[model samples]
Target chain A: MAKYLLLKHYRGAPDPVNSTPMDQWTPDEVTTHIQYMNEFADRLKETGEFVDGQALAPEGEWVRYDGPGSPPVTDGPFPETKDLIAGWMVIDVENRQRAVELAGELSAAPGAGGRPIHEWLELRPFLSQAPETAE
Target chain B: MDERLLRSLIPDTLRILIRRGADFASAEDAVQEALLLALHRWPKDPPRDAKGWLISTAWHRFLDAARSEQARRRREELVLAEPPPGPASGKDDSLQLYLLCAHPVLTQSSAVALTLRAVGGLTTAQIAEAYMVPESTMAQRISRAKRKLAEAHFTEPGDLSTVLRVLYLIFNEGYSGEVDLVAEAIRLARELTKLSDHPEVHGLLALMLLTEARRPARTAEDGRLISLAEQDRSLWSTTRIAEGVNILQRALAQDSLGEFQAQAAIAALHADAQAPEETDWEQILQWYDELVSQTESPIAKLNRAVALGHAHDPASGLAALAQLDASLPRHTAASAYLHELNGDFATASRLYSLAAQKASNLPERHHLIRQAARLSGTDANGPWPGSGE
Candidate 1:
């Protein structure tokens, strides 16, 4: 078994088939999209593939230590920032193919006009301890 | 009265009940209940016939369970058709349990969880914690596995190789958890040895031991991955090395070489080295040749390229790598290493960064980032290069 993180980047990633933003979509479309997400997670739970998932807030700022005596520095949430993550889902599956398949299915969640979003999902596997015989 | 001794009795204890015509799921439940009773009463009131005590208790429970279910009559007939438990059956039961738990129809994860529960005698919670899954999720996985086996109706013992593969997965596919999967794998391998005369079985055990011997120096106190070239040779377990070599020699003498034996030979060569410079890369490459020929596994081919770097030269390694699929896991890392060996620091640094981006685990990613930063004249402990988190 292997664990994979399916990442949903709000920006930086290529445009989806359905490019309309969620805020621009009709209220009915938004509800249907959300329902699809909930149903997808429930199905994964039944299959025992889902591990964890969360939707992130759009707002964020960069924080850093200033110096030995000063408070931490906080930078603006610059509009110019190109990278933005919408959410992520963690899954444990039988193989990479299964992980990719599930991610593809999730990417098919209904979007604007009640059609598939076809969003690009970044699938990454978890690094584990090198097996004893790997060396 | 020892916990390990109690656990050691589990597989056969459960198997005997199943052999007496109880279904796998019911037999398991009955055995669990019997085990709980043994744990409670064994310390103060030990049974003289522990195995017999477990079987009778579990069998009674199974029968009682069958009575409550609708298919009670048919199940009772199945139990009645079987011969009474004989001493000769115990040895085969253990192996059969391994076969049943690791049946090919089930997914790898399901087989692993089932094996840990039925053969390794671990609690569902314990298995859940080890795999880093929720207890409910693990429970579902195990029950689904049992259901799948029942549907498959596979009664004959499965191939030994499938069981070996599952055990190998158990040993190798571990990161961090309360349970020590490595030791658990070795224990199961040892148990297998008691039932079979297969040379490959010993080969697997030897491979695990020889590899594990180097674990003392595999990581630093702060949990950083240490390259093999930098590992302290003095920290290696000589006892384990000796035992492993002895086991490998026995397996090799049979002259029926398999993939695990070939890999073990490579590990034995590495273990034989007293220093990094003293490592027998030529011998390692040779064993890798045997391994590649036997399995044709892509990972083995990738590893052979790495061995070529040291055995011949970095140029040959780079040429060999260029011929293979670039998308293979660790391909970028191998390229970076060969470039570093060829004194192409810029290329190595770039590839290291790329490899870091593709790294699957946090520690390996951190290590690769550290490598990339070190080569590029940046802070070795710099923040992530391409990670979104």
Candidate 2:
């Protein structure tokens, strides 16, 4: 069977009620979010559908190459950009339909106010091998 | 049933489950359960009819979930009262699921995930590994996507081109986790081609084949990246190249040229030549021109410059490079390579160093650094040329 990747995005999603800065959020909220995400992962594991997931630091550097006698330039955390990604998730499924189903469930994860965050997600499929004849 | 047979039947089984009105989410869960059951039972007492077994088992699992969720009561009634089971009657449902997954309401990423789950029969964990994300994150992503599908009004099927693009991306990833991405991509592409006779499908398949034919030579013995020019020609898969060529020939015969077909045509040119020097660079440049006409992308322009260097004068190639946006990834490296070819060592060295410093990934950085070191006649321990700091 083929594998597909489900991507989640928090595009202007409402901040949870306990939405303090990362450092200021009550320990319980932070712990709860982490624990919930971890527990959810375990559930996927039990079903043998668990793969891997990670939280991305919402910052990145851009590097550019200048011509000969020119030097490379670097940029980071540019002030103009607003749609910073908070984290991501990936899931394997049979087809696009199934992937959509899983993404729906993930969006239901409890957020700041212990309510569903209704976050946005993007699902992409992992390309597999060439057909046998092609090989 | 042999593992191979079981694996092959997964897509078909998933199609059936989805066709039976099992929402993409529930259908996937049911399929996963069926696969798990098969892993346990099939190894011991193999099913005489593997597809039948999977269909029956997955169908039952879907019913069980539907009953528990208390959703789709009307649909449940229809499923329970269906005609006695014969050969899988769910092919239509599966096709519909493909359409729904590719629905325009959802983002491309969600559509791809939904397609893989409903059509490919993979699990969230597998997809997560493929994307280097946690299973929980993947779960949430898929769940959100399905919810969108559930709410979406998919009046008509999506364009085949969109679906083909998604599958092409999958094949390009090559491999992840325990999954061979190339094989998965081909399987999906083959299935897609059966669903639609679009020439681009063939074009995509040919493109994948031609590119994959060089897989053996794409990497060095120690997993280092090897440029196409430096690849060991002997290791290139002639069989794959032939297959790609044959497919491209058929696609071209249609007299309709698409971006994929154009790209595949370029690949075919590379494959036809026995040595790099023998490559039909002029013809490839023509194809690139066609590609640019079809799709105006900076990366495409950058690639065209490389072909220009080979097909015409190096100075013209440099001029082409100058037109591209400097911020584009690999622009510096491409320019540096062109400079190196033009016998401009100082320029090449500087560009290489800049490219190396700006490299996003480790392997690319290492490669650029090596080039810089070589051009500047320096060792690793010493300060890079022009690095006064």
DockQ of each: 0.02, 0.02
lDDT of each: 0.82, 0.70
Q: Which regions of candidate 2 are displaced past 4 Å? A: A1-135, B1-4, B71-97, B378-389
**Candidate 2 lDDT score at position A75:** 80
**lDDT for model 2, on a 0 to 1 scale?**
0.70
Model 2 C-alpha lDDT per residue in residues A1-135, reported as the tens digit of each score: 546565543234444333322222232343444455666767777866666665543337678997888889888754543554445556666667766777777656554445554555566777877888984
Instruction: List model 1 lDDT by residue over B1-389, tens digit each.
Output: 87677778889888877766777888987887788788789999999998889889988988888887746466657666555665766778777788888998989999999998888877777789998889999989999999998888776558789989999999996647777889889888989988887999999999999989999989877566788888998999999999999999999999999999999999999999999889999989999999999999998999999899999999999998998999898999999999999998877877776776567765575566556755754322222212222
- Highest lDDT model number: 1
User: In candidate 1, which residue pairs get closer than 3 Å at backbone N, Cα or C atoms, i.e. clash?
Assistant: A127-B360, A127-B361
